[model samples]
Target: MMNATEEFDPAVRSILDAAARRPVHERRVSVDGASLSGALAAADADGRVPLIAEVKPTSPTTAGTRTEDPVDLARAMVDGGAAALSVLTEPEHFGGSVENLERIRAAVDVPVLRKDFLLEPGHLDAVKADAALVIARFVDDVGEMVTAARERGFEPLVEVHSGAELETALDAGATLVGVNNRDLASLDVDLSTFERVAPGAPADVALVAESGIATPADARRMREAGADGLLVGSAIMAGEPREATEELVYA
Candidate 1:
């Protein structure tokens, strides 16, 4: 049988390896007043499933580079009715940077999420976004990371791919959870992954569906499957961001 590290997708393993080499450093920035969970709640109250559009330049799965300015792309998404913005800051594999998140957060009034394979509390301290993604699959102690994020005044969005990880996240006091449809082990996407896992999630916590969503139909499908928010990356980044975002938001 393969060990945990061995089971990781090659791309996921590469990202973790790169993150491990970074120095533990602090780059403190003021937290924006916008709240990710609050945005989702507000959308829910308005009878809308919030769209968390992502500002991703490129990913391991992307076909080519996206040269658009991060701030411009973010503003377009917000103008299209995106409730929040997710800024990828992984740097190596994702072609993202903390500078981009900072710029986008400054450019838009909407909440900004720092999307990275965070492994330590110090990583949270280095960012300045409104929320941080603490992936359960990558961290040894999901609870510890969640607590650390809250201590730093960041809304922690615990991401899990399976039912067991979902339970672990809940046990760790996670109020905001993201169910990623893409499996990190194989990098395969299946939209039903959210439907299968979302039923078990408590109603009080905000649930976000991530990846594998492209059109209005897909957005509606996830909403019907119990998603409070949708986190879309490649689909929005592939073409006209504003129109793409509007399609999902209005869906």
Candidate 2:
């Protein structure tokens, strides 16, 4: 049996149930949010892989919760040449909060991706973010999530771990598809995961490699394997944010 934390359905259900209690009207997103897709395109336009540095406070893999201010972290990433930012909003497992997202959005000019166990359309209404992550492993209706994110002015970065999920993402009309190298169930990192699945991705859609990307070599490998961009968290957060971001962005 899969661990409860790793399973997608139960987690998503919990998140949605909690979100339903909040009023959408009070949480409407801003109209002038940054464009995530545009930022990624510009980074890769010069034939270099763009970096989407993540602002993650903690994770199952980390030793402890992050204490650095999110605003400071966001600024460092942008200063280091990161094309965009990914802010974790999952409060329990990741130690992330919506307030972190709000603060980071205010601190950085780059596009921000709200990374969470998101499901409800109202979730988008609750945040003033540029892009949202819709994990393919969890969502029963990928298209619905895509439509909701797009309607709310958020470009959805649909995440896929396998070929089937990639097809689902493509069918859902997702322009930006992220291939997560970490297995949701085991939380294991497989660098080959992206390379294995990226070849099957449609050429037109933007391909982003997420997780387990640390060194410039890792970034170079992902880029060589067809990833136009990278969404990196742990490594960047563990070191000098700006230096890590610049290293990966140019790698």
Residue-pair clashes per candidate, as listed?
Answer: 0, 0
TM-score of 2: 0.89
Q: Measured by C-alpha RMSD in angstroms, how accurate is candidate 1?
A: 2.0
Off by over 4 Å in 2: 1-30, 46-48
Candidate 2 lDDT, 37-136, residue by residue in tens: 7898897786656889999988777777769888998899899999999999877667888899988888778899999876556667766788999987
Best by TM-score: 1
Highest-lDDT candidate: 1
**Residue range 116-176, candidate 1, lDDT tens digits:** 9888777787768789999998888889998888877789999988999899999999999
Residue 131 of model 2: what lDDT? 91
Regions of candidate 1 where Cα sits further than 4 Å from its true position: 1-4, 26-33
TM-score of each: 0.95, 0.89
RMSD of each: 2.0, 3.4
